[model samples]
Target: MLRKALLTGCTGFVGHPLLARLSNCDFSVVACSRVAMPALPASATNVLVSGIDGLTDWQVALAGVEVVIHSAARVHVMNDQSSDPLAEFRKVNVEGTLNLARQAAEAGVRRFIFISSIKVNGEGTPLGSPYRADAQPQPADPYGVSKMEAEQGLRALAAETGMEVVIIRPTLVYGPGVKANFLSMMRWLHKGVPLPFGAIHNQRSLVALDNLVDLIVTCIDHPAAANQTFLVSDGEDLSTTELLRRMATALGKPARLLPVPSWLLEAGASILGKKALSQRLCGSLQVDISKTRELLGWTPPLSVDAALRKTAAHFLEHRTH
Candidate 1:
């Protein structure tokens, strides 16, 4: 019998690709979203929920689902305009997620897979000591805090209900349709703009979209993945300078980077109130995925360079469209 899986956030960057992958596999997917999606796979069923919140009903969607991939949540924004950002995040990311998990457990779902963020661990890490799976959570922002709380709730729910829970915290994910800082870097590199990140030597771990999706799929049926928290990355750490060079190579452009002192750049950013942005560019945040490798025996199929090339190719293909 084909395993039935209920997938939320089917229209999101990760969820969309995941739905496709599940549809192609032995799983019968019910793609749940707030709104309808275009060109959904024929093998998958589409179910629309009003919204994800503490009050939302998921019984119809959880009818025969053996697995639940809950990706829908209030994501992080640059400058949130809400009066109470934490409350807003808690409403959807924490309360809404737990509500769904409870319903899934009641409906006899075996596993609940949560798509979490690296920010749950912390904003940045020291140079040599990367965060491990067992690291204490120190979520900085409201969004990160919400994810951490949601994970806690899921674990408790699993223990109480005997429903397995798999939590995956992925680092900065980049690929086609990427936005924010990663998109900005690609734009600067594509325009042949001279970047001032030549001298900074901060290491950061990143995961490609395909690699993350692959990991999620692996955990769907992997026996050892139950009740496990995994940190996923490309397994190769890259400095800001090295990342730009790789992106330039992928874009087939000359790397026009000016060597600038990290402290000087940080000082300028602080003066301009862009300290957070500067830290992301000049600071280090790495995760050790050794547990994920040893326990699940899984490795990222795509290399960093190859993934960057795919991202560049997508950007170049859609730049004029």
Candidate 2:
């Protein structure tokens, strides 16, 4: 059967890689965007339709859209201030999401796939525990709070309209074209600089770009994905120190991590007004994706090491190019 898909955030990190994978699917895609796209595949009967817009303007394209992939969100960054952070995040992530959900439902779209973050579980990992899909969400930042709210809102809309809602919570995604923290870490490793991350011994789960994209496709095909929130990662957990070491190896750089005492690191963080940063760097953040694996019968295609290598190679190539 020929399925028509409506995709939001078509210009995002996840979307870029996903486009490549979707080229082979039984999908006729129509992309909606708020910002201008750099370029796109020529809209053919195969691609069917593609357009750019704010949520209010989605009706025309949403008319025959069979599925909607909502990946747009205002991500987290330090010291970020918008007049109303929650409102700002909600404007796009929540309200915009709801708008599309309603339209898709009205258009008889079969599924509404929401790309949520693991932050919906919590802000940071506790010393010993990993975040599970079943855990009650205790979001910290405005961004996390908004995503959780959207999850609730989407779920409500789905229930009201009888549209299948598939939620995917991906953790610390890393890959080429990666930005934010992952990019910062790559730059730090490339510098051959020593880091205090050696004192941390907490495992955090992360999903590679390819692995995450793969799971999205899986969810599209898996009946179990309907009306479910699936936690996904590489299924490999690493402490901050271990992560730095592995990233360094990927870049062929020395893992020059200093073994500072945890308490001392905390004290230094306090002095630097970076207690949050200290906690994040030294804390154990992990995600249990067994629900995704067992239910969907899927596994990550690339190991974390391979994913890191590919990301590093992109950075290297970027510099050379």
Candidate 3:
């Protein structure tokens, strides 16, 4: 009697690894994607659909699927010169996600696991003050606001339809095939490029791909996770300088960091119209996963150092020479 699961975003950064791991679990997996995907796991079923939106239908795909893991969303856009960023984000993240969940509930799906962002807790935290799951949500950006709205919608739907909902808000996730700032940092570390984060001291929590996937799988059948919102991260927190040093060590290169003042760096970035990047490099954004740990008795299986080493190794191996 294998439980059936439908997974959205089967081709995304988190979705790809999740699909592979779920294929080995006791449950039968149905991998759904909007774009073209590579060969899927033999034991898993693959389905293609249009973009996630209010009009997107999942009738055939949701048939007999007991669990739904909604991982697809409009993630961060670097140069979002859009007229109305919130409208764009809401169109997919809120309307699209709710549409899927609503259809899943109608199709008799038992549980819906949503992969949300810690940005829903607000951008950054003060030193030593970690974000708690119950904290008042103060989503700053349009993306965060959209995710928060989606969470609210899901909770409302759950109350009305009796469908279990599990919400996980994770910090920055990194691993193989990781792109954007994380990947750029790895490349710079591998090349031994001097960075100006030596003077920045801020604790930031992050989640490894393995840890995130492990928790998602655990939530699939964990009775306690039903209708619960959890903020998850690797227990250990690190500063930008420390992260660069660790990455350099993993790449067998020296940490060539310059002792530039945080204020000066911020000013330079502001002048260059990259204030967001500077803030991420110099700000504190820690997540307190005590609720997730105590409630589910779950802990991240991998350490930050181990995760960074694995990411660096993957980049080194796959980087175009």
Question: In terms of TM-score, which candidate is strongest?
Answer: 1
RMSD of each: 1.0, 2.8, 1.0
Ranking by lDDT: 1, 3, 2
Candidate 1 residues lying further than 4 Å off, grouped into runs, are none
lDDT, residue 58, model 3: 94
Model 3 C-alpha lDDT per residue in residues 1-321, reported as the tens digit of each score: 777899998888999999989988977888888766678777788888878899998999999999999999998887799999999999999999999999999999999999999999999999999999989999999999999999999999999999999999989999887998998888887787888888788899999999999999999999999999999888999999988898888888899999999889999999999999888999899999999999999989999889888988899899985
Off by over 4 Å in 2: 42-55
lDDT of each: 0.94, 0.81, 0.92
Please give, for residues 1-321, the per-residue lDDT of candidate 1 as tens digits: 778999998898899889999998988899998777778887788998988899999999899999999888899776789899999999999999999999999999999999999989999999989999899999999999999999999999999999999999999999988888898888888899999999999999999999999999999999999999999999999999999999999999999999999999999999999999999999999999999999999999999999999999999988853
TM-scores, all models, native as reference: 0.98, 0.92, 0.98
lDDT of 2 at 180: 73
What is the number of residue pairs that collide in model 2?
0
Error of 3 at 268 (Å): 1.6
- Please give the lDDT score for candidate 3: 0.92
**Candidate 2 C-alpha lDDT tens digits along 1-321:** 657777767778998677656656867667656655656654412232233223466667776777788886777756766677787777777887787788788888898899999888986777567888989999888888888988998899888999999999998889998887778888888887787778777778889999999999888868888999999999999888889999999999998899987788889999999988777777767888888889999999999999999999999889632
Cα error, candidate 2, residue 202 (Å): 1.3
Ranking by TM-score: 1, 3, 2
Candidate 1 has which clashing residue pairs, if any? none
Q: Candidate 1 at residue 272, lDDT?
A: 100
Weakest ten-residue segment in model 3 by summed lDDT: 34-43
